[model samples]
Target: MIVTKNEAPANISKAIGQENVTPAWARAVTSFPPSDRILSTILTRQAERYGERILLVAGEARWTFAQTAAIAAASAQALIDAGIKPGDRVALMCSNRPEFLQVYLGCAWLGAIAVPINTALRGFQLSHIFRNSRPALLVVEAQFASAIESVEAGVELPPRTWIIGAAAGASDARLSAVALPARGAAAPAGAVRPGDTVAILYTSGTTGPAKGVCCPQAQLFWWGIYSARALGIREGDVLFTTLPLFHTNALNAFYQALLNGCTYVLESKFSASGFWAAARRHDATVGYLLGAMASMLLAQPQSAEDSTHRLRVALGGGVPPQIHGPFRERFGVPLVDGYGSTETNFVFAGRIPPDRPGTMGYLADGIEARIVDENDSALPDGEAGELVLRAGEPFAFATGYFGMPEKTVEAWRNLWFHSGDRVVRDPGGHYRFIDRMKDSIRRRGENVSSWEVEQTIQSHPAVAACAIYPLPSELGEDEVAAAILLEPGQSLDPVDVIRHCEGQIAYFAIPRYVRILSQMPLTENGKIKKGVLRDAGVTADTWDREAAGVKVRR
Candidate 1:
C-alpha cells in the first residue's frame, strides 16, 4: 500500500474535493491493505519512486528521499553494531533535528522499537519513563545528559547510551563512530510487519504516571494517509511543524509529507512573530497549529507577510472558537482543526457541509466513532458524552498502553477505544468538542466545561493563553481558578476578569482566584500543565476577588 510518487493509490477513486468527507467516500477510498505495513518498506519504496525529490528540510539542510533512505539504512547498521536487537526498545531523547529522523527510521529498519522521549521532561518525570520502558539503549542529545545522569542515582538508566551533538568530551564514543552509509544493505528483506511495534511514545499523563503508547508501524502509515487525504494535502505541499518530534503531531507531519512525495520543514520551536516570514521563506503550503499556537499567532503584530506565503491550509486540533475564523480571515489561510490523540491519530477533521465555527469538525476515514455515556450506551446527537472510536481494521488504532494490561482493558472496555474526551455530535452530521472528562470542573452544583471557560477568557483583548481548572473549596465543591498569561504590554485587574465573565458564562463558572503568569508552565508535549497549576493554588500573589469583598452578581 506504499504510494509511489504520482502513482494512483489502490481502491481510491479520483481525489475528492475539500468538502467531501462523507462515510461513503471514506469507505470507497480507504482500502486497508491485507498485509501488515512496515515503515522500512514505505521508506524504501518512497526512495525508489521519488529518488531526488526533497523530502525533509531544516535550516539550510535539504535531504532528498534517496539520501534520507540511505542515512536511515546506515543508522540501522549503527544500532546493530551497538548490539540493539529486533524488538529491543531504543530510547531517543533528542530535540527535533535530522539526527532524530536517522535514529527513528534506523530502528524501524531493524524492527527495533523507537521510544521517543519528550525532551522537556526532567528529574522525577524523566526517571519514571526510564523505569517504565527500561530501554536497552539510550540515545540522548548532549545537552540533556546532565539531567538524565542526575536521575540515575535512584533509577537504572539504559545499559548503553549514545550522545548526539556531543560537545568536546574525550570519553564516550559518539554514535557517528559506528555509522554506515545508506547504500549498504543492513538487514534481510521483510523482517518486520505493520503490527510490529515501531515506537513507544510516553503520554503527557495529566492525572497519573505517564504510560507508553505502543504505536505499530502500520498505525503511523495510516496516520500519514489520513492526514494527507483529510486536509487535501497536494503533492507540492510542504508540511511544516514546530512541534517537537517526540509527539505524534510532528511524526504524522513528517510521514504525511513522505507518503505524498512532498517536502517537510521542521523548526526547533514555534515563533509567533516570525512565523509567517518563515513560512514564506520555506514556501510552506501546509502546516499544523495546536494548543494555544493559533491564539499566540493572533496576538502577534498583524503583518502583510501573513498572506504572502504559498501556505494555504493549516491542520490542527483544539483551536479557540473566538479566533478560529478570525485567524483564517486575517491570515488569508484556512485552519482545519480536527480532534484525535496519540491513541488515534486524526479521527475527525473538517468534513462535508462545513461545521459551525468552534465545532471540532466531522469524522475521518476507517473508523466507527460514537459519543457514549458512562454505561457505554450511545447518546443522542448534540448530547455531550465520551467519545469512543473503534477502527474498522485491527492495529489501526494504537495496540494499547504499553505493558499496562489492566489500564488497557479498562480503556478498551466494551471493545471501544475510549478517548476520555467529552464531545457532542450534531444531528446535521458534525461534532463539537466539549472538554476532557478528567479536566471538567464542578461549581455551584453545575458541571462547567473548563475548555469553554478558557476559550471565553482567552478571547479577551489582553489575554495571551490560559488554563481554567477547579480549585478545592471548603464548601465541598470546586471553585473556578484561572492561571493566565497576559499579552505583551497588556494588563488586567482580577475584578475586571470576573466582570468580563458576568454575562458571557454561567455565574458559577467565573474564576474566584486569578494567578497571572509570564508564561504558562507546559508539559513535555506542550500541553498546559493544569495539574501543576492546581497543585500551586492561590499563592500570596494570587488575586482573590472574594477576599477583596468584590460582589459578583448572577
Candidate 2:
C-alpha cells in the first residue's frame, strides 16, 4: 500500500482536483461519507479492522489497536462512573503522554467535552481557561500540578481531580488511591453523532482571554482524512509526533494514522537533537515538523546518516522558505508545509511543489475561501487581503467559540470565518500566506497572546503601557518583543521584567527583546498602532536577554 512517486498524484488528485494538487505526489486519496464521522465510531472501527497491528507507541510501551481501544473504552467508563454525563467538560492537563489520548478519546466516546489545557499556562492564562470552561472534572498528570495549583483562588478547581501516574511520594493527596481505571472496564452504549462537540480547544485571542474553539467529533475525522491525503500518507506508514497533544497537530496526527490503519509514535516532547534518532528507531515513514524543527535539524552537522531513516513524506507547517529546499535536499524527502489554525480546519492543503516554494497549497475541497479587503469586498487575484473562509460542506470547520458568542459572531461575520491572516491568491489558484493581521504572537510554535503578555507586563506598576509583537528570531520563526512606556519619573529593568514573567506565562512567551518608548503609537481609532511598532523593528535601544547571557529556567 506504499504510495510510489507515480501513484501519489492519483491520491492527491482524488482529494483535491488534479489541476489544484501539488505538482508531484505518490499517494492517492479515497473519499469518505460527509456525515456520521464520529471520532469514537471511527476509532472503534479502526480497532475492529486493524486488531493486533501496532497502533500506538509511547516510550517503551507498544499498544496494539485493540489495546488502545480498550484503554479508551475503560477511561470512558471511569468518567461515567465519576458522574460525567454527555456535554460535561473534562479538563485534561498533561504533556505528550499516551494517557492524553486515553482521556481525549474517552471523552469522545461518551459525547463529553474534553478541554485540553496548555501545560505551559500559569496564573491568569491558566485561570481564565478554568473559569471559562468550568469543567466538572480534571484528569491531570503528576508533573502539571504546579501549573494547575497556580490558578487564582477565585477560579474554582474541578470538583474531582484524578491524577494519571503520580510519582511516588507526590505531595498531591488526590493521587494516593486513584489510578486510571483498568482497561477491561466496559464503556457504556451511547450514540456518537458526528456533530457532537467532543472538545473545546483554546487558542490565544486578539482582544481578550483565550477563546475556546468548540470542535465537533467530525472535525477530527476530517482533519485526519484531509491531512493524510495532503501528506500522501501510505499504508504501513509509521507516523510519529513530538508535538504536545494539546495541539491539533499531534491530535490530528493520531487520527491520521488511526483512520489509515498505520502505526503511531509519540515522544514525550519535541527534541530537535533526538528527533531523527526516534524516527529511525521507529522506522517512521511519515512524520510532522514545526517552528525551528526544519531549521534545527538542518543545523545539525551533515552526516551520512541523514537519509538513513525510513521517513519519506514529512508533513508539517512553519518550514521556513529559505531552508525549505535545503531541508528536502539534505534529508532526501519532500517536506509539505501548509497554513492552518485551531478554529479553522486545514484551509490551504499541505503539499507545495518545489516550483512554488512559498505557497500553502490550493484552497482545499469543500471550503469557500476569499481574500477580502477591510470592508469584506473580495480582492482580485494576486492582491493581498484578509483570508476569510467558510465550510462549503457541512461540519468541515468548528461550530463556534465555546462561551464566547460575541467573539464567535465577530469571527463568523458575513457568513465567513475571518482568519485574521493576510494572504494572496495567484492566478494559478495557489494561496500564499502573508502576515498575521491579528496581534497574537507565534513563538516557538506556541501562540502567545499580545493582550495576555501586555496584561502581565502592565502588572508592573512602573510600566504605563506595553505593546507586544513578533520580532525576527535567529531560528526563522518570530520571537516575543515588547515596546514599553514607563510611568513619569519611573524606570524598568529588562532582566527584572523577564524574571517577573517567568512563572506568569510560558518561558517561550516571555519577551526576549524589550524596548522603552515615550509613548505607544496609536491609530486614528485610538487603537495601538502595532504596524507602526512592527515597522519600527528592534531599535538600537532594545535590550536582548540572550545577548546579556541571562537564562530563565522553567
Write the residue-wise lDDT of candidate 1 on 97-201 in tens digits. Answer: 888898898899888999998665554556778888889888887775655643535587676777777643323332232222233556543388888899998
Q: Model 2: runs farther than 4 Å from truth?
A: 1-35, 167-179, 350-353, 524-526
What is the C-alpha RMSD, rounded to one decimal, of candidate 2? 4.7
Best by TM-score: 2
TM-score of each: 0.75, 0.92
lDDT of 2 by residue, 293-346 (tens): 778888888888888998877865777778777888888877787777787786
Candidate 1 TM-score over all chains jointly? 0.75
At residue 544, candidate 1 shows an lDDT of: 84
Error of 2 at 220 (Å): 0.5
Q: Rate the local accuracy (lDDT) of all candidates.
A: 0.74, 0.79
Assess candidate 2 and give its lDDT: 0.79
